[model samples]
Target: MFKSIRWRVTTLYLILIIAALLMFSLTLKGFLEDYFITQLEDNILKETRLVRSLLKDEIVSNKRVKKIDRLVDEYSNEAEARITIIGSEGKVLGDSEQDPLKMENHLQRHEVQQSIKTGVGKSTRYSETLKINMKYLALPVKHSGNIVGVVRLALPLTQVKEALADIFSRVINAGLIAIIISLILGLSLTKRITKPIERMTEVAGEMAQGHLDQRLMVTSDDELGRLSYVFNNMADKLKNKINEISDEKNKIEAVLSSMGDGVIAVDNIGKIILFNPSAENFFEVKEEEIIGKYSLEVTRSHKLDQVVMESLEKGEEVSEEIEILYPEERIIRVKATSIKDQDEQIQGVVVVLRDITELRHLEQVRTEFVGNVSHELRTPLTSIKGYVETLLANDNPDSAIYKRFLNVVKDEADRLEQLIIDLLDLSKIESGISGKGYEAINLNQVIEDVLTIVMPKVSDKELNLKIDVPAELAMISGDESQIKRLYINLIDNAVKYTPNCGEVKVKVYEDDEKIWTEISDTGIGIPSEDLPRIFERFYRVDKARSRNLGGTGLGLSIVKHIIEQHNGMIDVESEVEKGTKFIFYFPKVK
Candidate 1:
């Protein structure tokens, strides 16, 4: 409770008020007691004087002791006091409230001795005879210029105490009233002072909770009001600064979230502090699960950990291509850089991972393509060169020898021309330069046309070409030439791979949503591993056989590209030595 400013203020106020009231009560009570005692003493002294005056002449004239005693008692009763008359010999000659014979000597009495020396004396003390506290006054009575006796009077202090009690009660009551009033006023003043401070405190708490718009109300022009104004101004500046920071932070987050490259940030202690969405997807872990965990624990990639550590230790950027196998097998190019502060101190490490699997695959394909093209051209050119050289060397050679060499040259030349054409076609399709001149093409008609073109080769092989196409199949959206090429590639590949007398089947049909086609061949079926890559350009399952059969090895690759250009899907199923089936689906026209 004392932590509260208002409570402390009110408590201090109450303490001061109570202290002042207590001091005032003590001082006032003392002053009143002294005054009442003095007045009572004075009244006792006056009554003593009267008793002495009444007895002075009588004592000088030797009046009866009994008479003096009666007179003293009369004066004492009238004054409501005790009176004593002592002779010059310090003998109590007469007394009221006590017999003179039983009384002690008066000369040694404090008041009597003082009165003898100073003519009058007064004292306050407990009286043995009265058995209570009393005020005493002593005075000298003289006659014929000689001291005859001392007259003393005493009064109990009970009345003075009663009067002081009454005054004390009144003072206490008034003090209590004043204190109550002060308490109320103090509470009001404290609340007024502290209410604004309390409000500012509350607003500051809200601001801490991210409610930056919370503000204080300045209701006065006092110190607290000025403080409120300052606090509000500070809050405004803070809010704007926070907003600016938040905007910048949001922009950074947006860039990170939208990035295709995975980004992970670790602190100086090697704990993961940030993990973007791409990083989560790349690592196959949730950000919440891995945040604040050690980088090595989450990724479990030695290369990734080494990259980050090397960057942090060397305060330089490190990059490497690393393969991850957990989520999926992918080649990722990672660039790790050490983050620094203005002081150029290494604060953490930031790692960016770009997936380069496709790029790497493309690079390998290009290398193989160059090698294949060189080999293919070399063989044909070598043949043509050999044939022409033989003809030139054979002077007066037989016509039959010349004709056979020329024929061999022509065949090689034709193969070279066909390989060049296939290369150009595959290049155009892969580069997305195959122009879109689409039309509604009949699937059955395209199949029939492709069959007619390959019928001679099928007949030479004696393969059973079975056609199961629906005569009235739905029309599909495609370029007519590309569709015909797609059919020709499928049927031609089947006939080339199948041995003599093998069965080749072509089927075309339609479902509610798509046109479907399947080509099956009883050929040397592709292996499971090779099936995935059979559609790559220049890839051949049986290289020698493919070349001998006049295949350029770009047929299946072209077929795939054509299907994709028409937004169709193609899949292949094969079993070694059993058969292979190529199935394709194209969306049907509404």
Candidate 2:
């Protein structure tokens, strides 16, 4: 009950009313007691002085105490109080309320002792003879400048207490009535005051639950009503601001999801706050699984974490290329920049990652291609130049020496010519300049054209040739000349690599949608590691032997380009010194 505002306010009001009643009752009670006692003290003091003068001569003359007691009783009856006569020897000579002989000595009495010392004294205490609370006043009786006896008067406080009790009873009754009336009125007022507050609390709760349309009712023009007005305005503004923020958040999410680059955002503490879809693809982790984790944990790249930290701490942009080895070795270009607020304080860091693995591989391939071309051209030109110089220097040379030098120069010139032709063919294939003439061609016819060209090499090697061209093989769509060249490279390689009496086999068949060819050679095979880059231009497994065999090293690269142009795939399976097999597939003409 106390948790609600109504109960709490009513309880507080009741407590205040009770406290005020108690304070007023106590203050009035104390004031009346002090005023009555003070007035009694003054009236009794005057009566004491009058009775002192009345018996002064009798007490000084040493008259019998019985006679003095008679005079004291008469004075007490007139004053309506107890009177005591004490001799100068500290002996009680007469008492109006008791026998003088039976009473204790009055010398030790507070008022009597004081009066003996200072002429007048007053005190209030319980009187044993009267069995009531009494106020005592004393004065000295004197004769011829000597103290004779003390005349004292005592007033009973029974009437004073009765008067105060009547006043207390009346005040308490009035106070109780005031308290009950105030409590009833205060409870009603508090309920009214807190009703609007409770409504505000309900509206606030509704807003917390995403019901921003809830509003408080303004029932009055008091402070609470004005407060309700302000609250309604605040709710309107809050709902609008929240809607705007939600729209902006959705827009940002759309942009991030569509981005090709991986983006990660982190707070200044280096925890992952945002991970986009591209980042999920790059790291192979789900966004929900990795959010709130550290950046290093998600990317598994300490270098990226360092760049993010550096950007966060220094509030600067940092760009770096980091390598991630898990899942695969990928080169990622990470660009980290601090996100700052309008006050220019760093709030977080945003790191954008672009997968540059393919780009880096292309760059390396280009560099090697240029280098290999330069070397290839340089070797043949240097040999031809040396041979020509020898011919020029030998002015008186024999015919045989001139002939040998000229033939050597001619062979190098032929090598240079073939190299140039291969280079041109490869350039055309890569640039999509070749293979534009598409037609339905028979696979066996193209392979026959290729085998006819390589017949001499096969015959020279005296190798056994195996041909398994299925007569019913389906026709495929491609450039006929390019297909012939593709077969020529494979068959020529097989013929060149096979030992004397070794076998070169060619097989052609068809699958559901493709015409398949398998070329297997029982000759020296490629190593396992070099299989990936075997199709790259100018890449030679056995460079010296290949050059010696009159091979241009561009054959396989050209073959790969031709197969791609025909919308086909080529695969190689090779084991060193055992055999090598080339399988290629081209889509059948629909």
- lDDT, candidate 1, 1-590, per-residue tens: 88989989998999999998898888988898888887887777777777777788866655477887888788877888888888887877778898887878888888988998899988889987879998889998877678778888888889988888888889889988988898899989999998888888899899999999998888889898899999989998998999999999999999999999999999998999999999998878999989999988988888889999999999999999998776688899999999999999999999999999999988998899899899988998998999899889888989988888888898889989999999998888777775566788887678778888999999999999999987688788878887888888898889988989999999877888998888999999999999999988778898888878888888998999989988899999999998899999999877
Best by TM-score: 1
Query: Which residue pairs come into collision in candidate 2?
Result: none
lDDT digits (tens) for residues 1-590 of candidate 2: 88887888888888898898889889988999999999998998899999989888879976688888999999899999899999988788889989998887788889988998998988999977778899999999988899899999999999999999999899889988988898789888987888888888889999999999999888789999999999999999999999999999999999999999999999979989899999888889998897788988877788888899999999999999989886689999999999999999999999999999999999998899899899999999999999888878878989998899888888888988999999999998899886467889988778878888888989988999999988777888878889988998898999888888899999988889998899999998999999998898888899999998888889999999999988999999999998899999999999
Q: Give the Cα-based TM-score of candidate 2 against the true structure.
A: 0.63
Question: Model 1 off-target regions past 4 Å?
Answer: 1-3, 57-65, 87-91, 105-108, 116-119, 140-149
Whole-model Cα lDDT of every candidate shown, in order: 0.88, 0.90
Cα lDDT of candidate 1 equals 0.88
For all predicted structures, in order, the TM-scores are 0.92, 0.63
lDDT of 1 at 256: 99
Backbone clash count, each prediction separately? 0, 0
Best candidate, lDDT: 2
